[model samples]
Target chain A: MRLYFEKRKTASKKTLVIVPAVSLVISLILTGFLLLAFGVSPLQTFAAMFRGAFGSSRNFAETLVKAVPLMLTGLGVSIAFRLRFWNIGAEGQLVLGGVAATWTALFASPYIPSFLLLPAVLLSGALAGAAWAGVPALLKTRLQVDETLTTLMLNYVAILIAEGLFYGAWRDPGGMGFPGTARFPQAAWLPRLYGRVHYGLIFALILAVVLWFFIYRTKWGFELHMIGKNRTAAHYLGVNIKRTILISILISGAFSGLAGATEVAGLARRLQEGLIQGYGYTAIIVAWMAQLNPFASLLAAVLMAALLVGGDQVQMMMRLPAAVGLVMQGMILFPLLAGSLFSEYRLRVSQPHKEETS
Target chain B: MILLVQSVIAITIRAGTSLVYATIGEIYTERSGILNLGLEGMMLMGAVTAFAVAFHTGSLVLSLLIAMGMGMVLSAVHAFLCITMRANQVVSGLSITLFGTGMASFLGQRLGPAENNFYLVGLTAARFRRIAVPFLSDIPILGALFYQDILTYGMYILIPLAWFYMFKTKHGLNLRSVGESPQTADAMGISVTKIRYLYTILGGMFVSLGGAHLSLSYTPGWTENITGGRGWIVIALVIFSMWNPARAIYGALLFGGINAIQFRLQIAGAAIPAPVLNMFPYLATIAVLVLVTWWESKGKKRLGAPAALAVSYMREDK
Candidate 1:
């Protein structure tokens, strides 16, 4: 007997949803085994995680707070991925955004009027992210450098640049020599929506709807998808491949930058080493899980945020290390990737000799 | 100043060994049509596993073996995802790194240093000690290179052997063909899937060996993120060397020298801020990548990249 995969003529929508659900269940089972290996009860640990993320209103709010950056970054990554542009440097771009926001809040805000302060800071952050993303995009278009490698290399450079500033000129003088910038003034702080959640939630939600309109509703969005599916085909259809790619990457970087900027303005209120907590990277997974849909990315981001917040609970309550969340997140992607195969193809069993004879 | 130069050179060779191992490993994997971005995670896993095993069993050989085995196992997951399932290689590789790093960190928390500065306990006995070669150790300026650990010496042999195997052997040609044009290789009766899986796993073992070398010889202690972007540097080095194993040695030395100088400057109380000094290697890597990429494009060189690189093969795909 032999088994092989046959391509489906048309994918079933039911399978599309069910496969990922199956993958998630399998991943959870695998993670349960890992928890067992660590001498923890998977059931109680999961319950604790659920409670930590959503049991209380405040906990749910914290989960949303975490989801804010993930959503923004996820949207950013989805934009680039749609163009077949691998922008792995979202982390660095996000950090650079934070740096730009810090510059605005620290220097420009004190000089500008109160009304202009927030917009200037946010705009600077997004522009900074776009600028950082421009390097790899230019290289890809002009020199044919692989953006995956170049973007990743730039991530370290961005982090180092942030570290350099924080440890040097940006170090708070009055705060006992800590390696972080001075706090943002009241005008610069993003107004909280209750608990720790901030206005970034609104920004992310509005952007998601706008992006959904842009990607699925607009002609330019169709061109982006066309290029992603096939560059030659897109060119034949009059899509300016190079210009579209460059613009898409810039927009992608802007979204990631906004994520970083909002993170600092809304939560941290200061640029520091921890400003980038892998939210940008997590956004990659979230974007993939969302199938690059803007609104789906919002849902995916919330789910990922729950995992992250719940991981922390497992660490505190179950005495497991905080790295457990990372492990779970990583494990989830594999099965998800594997399960996606079922969407495009189905398995068939046959006897080789009998087929040939027939 | 001469003594300082000699010591720095010595440290460069020692530090460069792990990078050389990793670069060669990646070269091997990429040559077989897959790019494993999980080098960092795999290395971290190897480092932590070696440290844990050595801490418990106190057997250097066993620890090294287990580390390599662990790396192979991780890469096998990558192979299954990339080859069998036809998953996006970049996402799969990143996922592997994330999973490996997370698992390593989780395990490290359990087996790592009980307190700061106390990580070296029981590790020193299993650590690779420098062995001086007769008459070779007496050579001036280069004498320190002749006296090094077993892993460094093994690398000296492995580099040349890898080059020979990749260039001069029949299997090497088959592997290259698979990477360059998997469909053609498949039509010509070569098993593209088999070659890919074999080389990726083999490449993973070498990468893990480099990680074990870090824990067992160079640093002799496990720390969170012990590889510290070295895996990414190796990725850059593979490009800088234009996928040539022989050329990778120079790339490794250049990076290793920068790392050594950073430490020396800090120790010497250089006036430069420590953070700026620390950025030297990463900045240099970016510079090297850009320069090499530009040079390759300008010269109209073949770029030496396997044509089918990163493309998953399916037998029935049009």
Candidate 2:
């Protein structure tokens, strides 16, 4: 009996380990096919990409830098998804948050001290993101508007708003009429780690840990999970569904906002029209691939960040377009989804219904 | 004031060009119990294919046909995942959008940034000129309505045909029945799977028309992110119209009007911030969504979506 139990345990462990490992191997092979299509040697291209993304300390710093926004946005998506609320407008929220950060930095320049101004700017960014998210939340709660459609539509509106601000009112005066805000003050900048990577990575890590605790340990988190699992049952159990959804969305939105604020403060140090590079959208894939778990999302974010860093190398070394990364990223999600499908249902072949009946 | 009215008419016609096709396409898919979130991606594929083929061959007619074929193939991918494999429709659709957009953008970048000339070899720009009846063209304000491109007229005719086909035909009823409850349709001798596949493929063809409308009829050139968020707007418009084709036309026009006014407001130098003005269409959609839901939710007579609408069908024996 002892030997049988040990064998059973080993078999289960093998099953658990092999599934994801197999998926990774398949995705890599598919990515190799993509490289071949682009007329580059798959092994050499990937080797160069690995080297370019992690060969030197500079590349490593850049990889961490890229991971900051991705991790925050992934956390945002995973949080919302945990509550069964599909928040697909993280991109728009990031844009609005970036705009808010820029506005705060610009307007608060003379009055606030450097130390005080930075936190305030970041706070404003979070507020703006939440408020931007509040529109769809209100519509969904009050009027029963579909959050999915509203959030998706609002992204374009947010893009236009950001464009309008940079092109019209926020154009820098002394910077040759460029369509961007003035450089942020030194006080507005985020503190860097080792003077290379910004403190955004630290913030994202801390936030991830906090989110992990809240999701797996806290009472409110339990309530959110209950509602997510079943809205009607949670309602009967005395949980306020609308309030939970609002709070869930607000928290998610704030994370995305902080991501944008970090980008402004840590990387750009100013608002540009193209500040966000679709990190919000890409986070959707990361969150889903991680099955909406916060800790899992952290690892997923790192993997995605590595891909982005590698994509740049693919462009520079292999003369491949950067969008090749996008294709690979996109293709990975398909098989990732297919893998998850097996977790839910087991496939079985059967004869035709007539023959079965006979 | 005249220019404003004219711009309203012009923009309404222009905006309706894409929305008309998308709304109808979504109507077909939703009626068959599949919420194709990949409509945006299909439209992008349509736009790219239309532009690429039209640029190379310089044949507008063949370009539209190719666009339809491209959309059919892309939509087939969604159908394969959703119907055959029974995957999550939303996830599959999202994946298609990501894949389509990435692929299109990658190809567009390779093709370079300059606009490819897509004019017919023999026909000039006048070949697409508006046609107006003598009596109707003389009518005030309504006169502007009488003049339209050939595609606009196609949409005008298509709206009624769609409504008739959806409500009056046997296949339409079967599709709707499947949408309402695929199990019920399965019990009633209708092939739910076959209906879904047919309608999904047909829906894709219609959405490709929207994409072709952008490249061939409306925008007249290839640009990155060309369809913008119009596809999403059409999705919202579908719900706002309660999946009715006739209502979708007016919704499309209303959205187009808002779009035109925003551009005009920018040009006229309205005192309101352009950002705020540019926000009008989306804000208007939010308002419309709220109002429609409120209107539908009143008197305990709910006008909810079809119950089985986004759910995958599992043919499990009891």
Model 2 lDDT per residue over B138-193, tens place: 77666777687777888888999999998899877888899988999999999888
List model 1 lDDT by residue over A10-55, tens digit each: 8666765786687778878998998887677888888888898898
TM-score of each candidate structure, all chains considered together: 0.95, 0.87
Worst 10 residues of 1 chain B by lDDT: B116-125
On lDDT, the candidate that comes out on top is: 1
Q: CA shift at A144, candidate 1, in angstroms?
A: 2.2
Tens digits of per-residue lDDT, candidate 2, A1-358, equal 0110011212233333354556667767987886677556888877877876777888877778877888888999788887777788989888888989888898776888878999988898888888878888877877777787788778878888888878778878776866788889988988899545788888888998999899889988988889888888998999988988888898899888888888888887878855758788878877877777777788878777777787788778867666666666767766666655455455554456534542
Tens digits of per-residue lDDT, candidate 1, B238-272, equal: 87777878788988987888778877998998887
User: What's the CA RMSD for each of the models?
Assistant: 2.5, 5.2
Predicted structure 1, TM vs. truth: 0.95
